[model samples]
Target: MSSAREPKAPTRPTSRDYRLTMYRTRHDAAVRRLAASLRGMPADIPVRLAKPGSNLFRFGGRDRRPGLPVDGLDTVLSIDVDARTAEVGGLITYERLVAATLPHELMPTVVPQLKTITLGGAVAGLGIESTSFRAGMPHEAVREMDVLTGSGDVVTVCPGDDLFECFPNSYGTLGYAVRLVIELAPTMPTVALRHVRYVTGRELFDGLAEHVDDPEVDFCDGVSFTPCESYVTLGRFTIEPGPTSDYTGQSIYYRSIRRRDTDRLTVADYLWRWDTDWFWCSAAFGVQNRHLRRFWPVPLRRSDVYRRLVALDRRIGLSRRIARARGQRREAVIQDVEIPLAESASFLDAFSRHIPIRPVWICPLRSTTATTPPLYPLTSGTYVNFGFWATVGLADGQADDHHNRLVEQLVIDHGGHKSLYSTVHYDRSQFWRDYDESAYRQVKKRYDPTGRLPDLFDKVVGDNATR
Candidate 1:
């Protein structure tokens, strides 16, 4: 065994303060017998197993609540996985679980914004994605869940059953999810990669809706970015199995899926590319920031992209320019703002008019049916999420603040909201606007009446989740 242990940081909090040890064993969780050994430790902090390298560890940051406390941490007990359904450890990342179930030809129905999220996180928190349009949030993918209740016991919640309505996106608020049993779509061999370009916001959004509505597009959708002048939107659809005229189906592992192509990549490389955000954000930010990442947003409008498609060619020149400038970033805040899908075009136009921030890019996330109400209430209909990734200069703080206010206003104006998954120093009103208050309160009152999860957020839902 490796003698090296994780460095114990004196500054890192202990269970005494609701901080627990986070563990990552080489193969399995070494934490199984922890309940007995942790008898003397602070009861507040809970043990969590980090998703073993899979990005889909959990849909949202809260789902994998690894090391996050249960006094505030919510989990139910006993997980069971069968031929039709499989129960997974809440801490199970998507990759391991997917691979484990491969022999059975089954996969989780709903995944997260990114595949790296954990199964528990998807069931409990990872809410938005293309799969949502049809199958719904990762929770809708679940047929039943084995949850550990606040009273130190377990219970089951099944779809269409009496105790079926536990809110999945509550971030474990209803209970700690020990096991989640979800259904799977038939396994496919390869996905057809379709690439196209859009010219305006109206066209971009309309095109997305039409494309995502198709079932064969297993992972329907594309990313937009500005290569030279106009925004270019690339759409991808998973090809159905048959003798393909183009290419045969190959198992796409994550590594090959995530790549920094000025064009397209396999499933895995496209998902985890170190430069994906850069690629994803480049459409609005200008490939200039590649000084930091290879990928940036791909713009949706053709006219919005740079005239030249020299993203890879211009790397050297851009890098030199950035180095010469020194200290100040030539790029902007990469501001990440999201508005509902249906409300996208209007909000996009409104936000662009109000905020002077140039090269503002948009990333959309459609609402799902299985979404829980109030907290992450299922919208009356689908709402498109527009991410305004603003590229600003440090000198652009005024612009940043100005756009942030625009963000706050737009979020409220649209009946749609922004991304809570990513950090965006928001005000209480913004969070309240994004989430439902009454639903949050009811869940908070039920399990964590002591208010131990306040360590959870800085502003919204009472500003304090303390026990």
Candidate 2:
């Protein structure tokens, strides 16, 4: 410790601050009635809806937000999952979809955290991590989309249509992702679990790069540790039957991707990666509650955060236990930003050098698109990218401010743009830097003549939607 006689200095809050994005905050009933009244046009306006709750946060990819109304986007659709596809209303969470589709042997290759996520939300903001190298991004799974545009009209776009590509990761800024026609994955009863430890970020990434090429490998990644010491490299892949299959050390058949299906690992051990389960209050087992509100959008970088994250991952459970005993929520600003696959290394370097490292994960965005073109964060041709975010405990806003500066510069350095984002308090000029103005001006002119969507999203990257 430094000399205590020195003056006390100021500190920053570890939490990512959120502006109750509810302007003119209306109840679900009123919003639904209003949305219902405004339906039947070619454009769809943005409105909050009601939901149960999930791990995927719209703002920070942490705790779930209150649900909202998405039924008004449909056209006499009565069911959830169809024969060839699922006509999921924007409201349904990823857990419900997975549960509904399991019987059909159809897996929605969305964010691995499927137990709680929205089909529309996932499509609007794409993510395909370990499985992405195999399946591509979430948008690729969409068969068709019924977008609720700002023009007060609902437009249906499919694979061959012009409006098909702008659907995913655009966030809610380009109106709501009212409905989706998602593709499915095959069913496998058991997954081979592999845990290999590494000492450094390079070793972990190299290991991951090596394992991704194997055919049986379903998902693989390097868990936090150091390049000089031990780290967990966990993987889940399809299990094949034969004489060799019987000789296994440890494996499990997980119902959902949330936790490791463990026949032997303790609850704490099983959920070593599922940190939220430990952070939240649950009486189910002796789980304690740490009350730090979880949600903050932080830019994701790959290389730099990998090792720092490993160290944090190891301590989350124990720290939460202590916090719960003390009756204080663990304050964490979970910032998650996705970049193109090629940018992962450079971005990660920026993060490790700039921000306090938290747990990070990699996701994928499809390379091919019919209408949506490539820019910076918005890449073209099938590609993969990862996200880096931090979960810290603080009381002042300095941590958040730091995140802002890092992300702001990151955007410029990476030559990228964010789509349909939930900005904290940035200016229009910063947003405009990511997305251009020409396409947005034309589209704004045609649809929202009063200029509503731009306040939510900067501008469009294409001319087809505007026309």
Candidate 3:
């Protein structure tokens, strides 16, 4: 050891320090405080680390309006670069994580298109992205997590642990993920992207399969405007920049039927490429006004544009009134169902005939379950997520329910699973038929013995008569 008389060296900037300094504050103690608050509370009480406006809380049949909201947990805890991991609070957004990791030349393996997605939401809600075909779901990339149980116990969980598997798609009904150590991978400064057009679902699947299976391809997704017209986009991290292709500057959104050539984009641009137009679906909001789009583009680039739109809808209250006036609970249809690759053609055919949604996003995702692991929502298979979202004219509220059940039937009939982020019409039998509730219940009992959190079945299979 050096002598005291000797000048001491300055403390070097570590990855942890660099990352922690990026955030405004650290609320590590808030984890246990939130857990303790839930100790004798009513089971119906809802707990969240973030505000309700940040998420689709009222989606599906359940209206999870917060009773006891837990705020101030949105902060980046730490980032350990040497271990290739980033420890983030559950409420921390992907946008913050991106900022913390980019300085270190690292990125989360799988990030949803929306940067507003929280680490806990992504893990608990089963988030996947274009890169999910290779890296698997965001939950699969979790290295470790600090979970607060209903019994006021804070437990550290890791992969292969019993409670770890139940956390995915549980919707925080089992327990709250206070902190998470997410695995990170090295990323290039830029990403090279190419789009290939396909006339049929089979051709689109074939193209997607080819790219997903290719080791060189880093990201892959497909957008179908019609049953006969689709485009498959494959992206790869690249050091050398090729021809410039900027989607933000175009007259029409990139997801439109217009053909495009290979181009290069910054990694951030590649990740949030759809934000400018919300996958060409923002035409519903009049962002499609070509003249206005040219003059004003900055406001459209906001990451929370979708959330803002919902807030505007709620603020105006006219949309809800319109639905009420029409005796309808829904005026739009937005659902994502992940089905086996083989069933894609059939499902798309049915989807085209039923909903006929345009700009259908199809992202290939590989299941991460073991060869014989207890069955989860996503069974072992090569699956493709079909994001079918569009306005559906409903004669009454019951019609929306009919559409919900019809879609659920189509998914089940085709051997697929639904994304719980949207409305789920599954009853107890139907829900258990798709998920291994037995295993989930066991894990729930072990961690949340007091039943402080909401019941899993109650939260997932809401008692709404619509179902």
Candidate 4:
């Protein structure tokens, strides 16, 4: 050109760039508000989170203390498609996170079975899924996290940090995760399933061990209807277009395992298959009944909805009254325990003989790294997670915690550990022995020296804690 043209104006940000910037700004403001709230809290009272819902089965009187306001903390801030990473707010549920990531053809390394489970809650507590045998637990996928410590400081902790190492299974005693950078894995458009039936527990566990290290299998878990009737379901990702089954409607997922030897589902449906019927626990509320299933709204068919109904029953003692009227004494025996693969059969045999609950869920897991997280210790090897949720009739002479206590001792005897998400019956010494007390104290001291949060033992064990 004959004349020098004026420099072009700076390029404007793209729509995605603008949205990401806005999300980050809102996240930062929310963090500041939470930190200020924590700092303003009186030293005498223990702290709690003002979350809308909880997946925890520990039911009791609600804490009267005002909780920290955590508004705007349940958002997905950014996603790096090329890097296969996502930075999400702590309170973001896996359901929402999946929605955000699926369009990019990616998903978290290990998506827990339930959709309502929060990213932060899964990290702070523990979460496992079918992919756990290869990818490990949810916390193992976190690249870094911003935790709001009890001292009112927001610290970005990575893998090597002591706080980060002990954060899982701490159950928020040290601090609460506000933002997390997590690794993601590519996903196919659909998943194909194969249900292999086994006649015995030994056969079931042996069949499971074979698939744990197989590169071809993308997902692995088993269901034991009884000692003699069990099925090891294996899932594989596929790109081939095919007609998929619909379990969200009247057809139940667990029942399908028993009926169908082969099935196919879209990636999203496969990840949340168990959530539709709450893994057969919906039977307690008559949702499994064909008559009632017709009337149950599809949108409300969620794990959280069933959990709320359970909470309401607990509040009014509806189940207790029903049992009393029937001249029966039943104890809720909801629990998940992990046993070394070699001893899984023995543990399951003992469980079948003692605990009457059936349709036990068995998921295999292995640590992604050689070094296990300190709080929830798992040596570098394969372990089987057994989950059973139902009420067992208590003998006239037995205590309410009889079955739970037996499960705890059985887990210890089998060289295993039990998850603390449900009712805990351990004394202080026993609980400390099962979990590394020394390691916990050191990390707790470092992150929360003033002890703004409740102690792990007191928080989890509740009234059962032996002072």
Candidate 5:
């Protein structure tokens, strides 16, 4: 045995380790504070979250009650580069998550199109993007979650748990997620896109179905400009470096789809390509005009900014007033519905014949697992999510929800389900029937036995006051 002791190694923590420690400390404190706040609230009073903004299109009456404070919950807690797993705050937006992970060459398995869509919102309310065909919805990527139940207790839930299975489309009626551990996927420096044009909807669906399972393709989506014109855009990750196009400035991303056969974008831009123009809805604000776009500030060109403008218009009823002044009544026909791949063409045809909103967004998705979520029971086959946002003129005697009702019936007839984030016109019995009432009630009863939060039907389709 040597008498002299070997030199001791330094015990100081690395920068990344220190940061992760602080993040975890902060998250734990935040969760405790939120739980206490929920407990302090009166039992009879219904609770609601005080979010800074909302992506939901159902512009319901404001909940006058004070909201639960969630100040410190929006953050990326930790990213394990080796395991490709991220522990993030539920309120953290995908934009921040992307910013944090991109440097590590990792990203969430399925990142929604909009930058402001929070991870919790995406998981609880459901979200889809081009990658959904293989990766499934945002909830599917979550390995575990810490949810603040309506009983004012925090519990960790994982796959195979009843709460975990039913939580996706529960829309916060059960409880709110505070922290989630989600899986990540590797990424390259850039993405190469091919805009393949088709003459008809049938041809477009046929072509799109072929690429859904293509191992070479990493992203798949399409734009239907009209009944006669459609284009399926296929994107693949590439290490090949090239001069990528910039759509944040004078050029626009959606327009590029029509004008170019091929395009390239940095991974960040590729993920948010639709957000730059709100999927071309910014044209309604005249930002697409060559002259106006020149003066528009680059930083203000975002989906959230335009959404606020739309909200303002809704608050003041400005668009309704303008249309009424012009002797026309317009119904806002904004909705996203997922139809089976086989029936997508028929739905599109009926939609075009009735709604007249063009440039429908088409993204295909499939269940990554054998069993489907109970709340939004999508079968184990492929489905096409059709998103259209535009106002259509209502004839003199038409109900305000005439177009929306038509859409609901169309979805039902086509063996599809409509996303509840937007306006819903289904009757109570029918709504519960479609959403699986028995399953939802069981989960809701267990998580929120006292009915602290509004029921799913009440939250999405009930009176505006409850929403």
Candidate 6:
């Protein structure tokens, strides 16, 4: 483990509190606005693109750290129900996307668990879900996009285009995705959900792996509540609407709250079911105690409750303030590592022994489904993504930092790639060992030669190279 370093002081919040409702579809106006902003800014300043600031982890500075800003990019530009495609502007939230698509009996093939995540963030970060085993990442579903380049060029990027291929995991370093033509999938009226339980970790992993190639399964995810006990739930679209119930409104379906066996759920209800208490994984946030997690219905919708919880820490200003005041991070860590199928059993065992992060989420992702390989490092073969999200202990320098590095090393050693959505402690060399730095640099140079956007290396590993 590396030596413990003091937590840096908290600067101004990078993301300003803004509302997407202020503006409507204006792609042409947005293009001209972005072009003018880029033209006016100095060449050396990197440009920053942001959403409404509800990400569970920080990818880059919320505000433009070394750059100029071009705000109000979040808009749904257009929705083509007949073509089953949506032309989404930069920074549009998944919630808005879902609302628009549901009315047309269609939805994006893959949506991240959280509705707070932006379409662009999912494209740039790790956006995988139970359905990912078939549809791949959210970015893969994008047919094309209109990008406002750092060099002040408004170019259309198709699936195979250089800019389009490298856009995922670029963290807006390449340019701002002004308009995205995303492919949508036809959705059933309801989802036939089945919960399968296993007594052992090996059994759970193997069972989940077997269904990766199953054509019938529309969505699949596993949860590890303890070292041994786990449950894998598989859902398929159903033409027949099962017993209708409003599960999304008032229930706490976090992993802890979910049953080992369950019934059917509406398509929309099942999609955002984990919104309450993050599938009971918020136990790490002192919400694990059953008593604290159960709150009376305040008339607020299920989506509102979960959205508030996701932003609670930031709104209260407790964790970051404490870290800044004490030079230590006391908040929980969220990470997802994509592990090859063959090594999962042993890797899960190693995780149980070395890390105690609990209520772990296991999701399968397909390598073949994704047309454009994400800029982030992902193993080539089909893999299982282990979502190790929890607050093991306080980041009092040595212990937490050591634990984090150990987890990263475990992922690398076991043929896995760590998702860069959370705090990335990797040095430049370590990052490149897992990522393709040369390819990233080449793409950045082509689209953003003036350094208008920050490079992937700077965003993930920082400017200073570490041993």
Alpha-carbon local distance difference test for all models: 0.44, 0.44, 0.71, 0.89, 0.87, 0.69
Measured with C-alpha atoms, the lDDT of residue 262 in candidate 4 is: 99
Cα deviation at 351, candidate 1, in Å, is 4.4
- Candidate 6 lDDT score at position 209: 75
| Model 3 agreement with the true structure over 368-414: per-residue lDDT tens digits | 54622233456647899988766665653355457777889999889
lDDT for position 233 in model 2: 36
Candidates 1 and 5, the one with greater lDDT: 5
Per-residue lDDT over 1-467 for candidate 6, one digit per residue giving the tens place of the 0 to 100 score: 11112222212323232332234424455667777877887776555543335564553323434333435556665567789998677677787888878888999888887767778778866588888888888987888777777677777777667777777877767777776789999998888777788888788777887887788888898887788777788888888845855544444565422553656777787777766456555444555454654553433333435545655765577667866796655535678888887777778889889787777888888854444354565656778888876655554455545677778888888888887777777887888777777777777787778787666777656423110
Residue 86 C-alpha lDDT in model 1 = 59
Who wins the lDDT comparison? 4
Cα-based TM-score, every candidate: 0.61, 0.61, 0.86, 0.96, 0.95, 0.83
True lDDT of residue 324, candidate 2: 64
Tell how far residue 302 is off in model 6, in angstroms: 6.9
Score candidate 6 by lDDT.
0.69
lDDT of 3 at 396: 39
* Per-prediction backbone clash count: 94, 37, 0, 0, 0, 6
lDDT score of model 3?
A: 0.71
Where in model 4 is the C-alpha error above 4 Å? 1-16, 464-467
TM-score of 4: 0.96
Model 3: weakest 10-residue lDDT segment is 1-10
Tens digits of per-residue lDDT for model 4, 37-75: 999988998778888888888887755777898888889
Q: Tens digit of lDDT per residue, candidate 1, span 169-228?
A: 455545556555676654444334444456666777787677666554555434433322
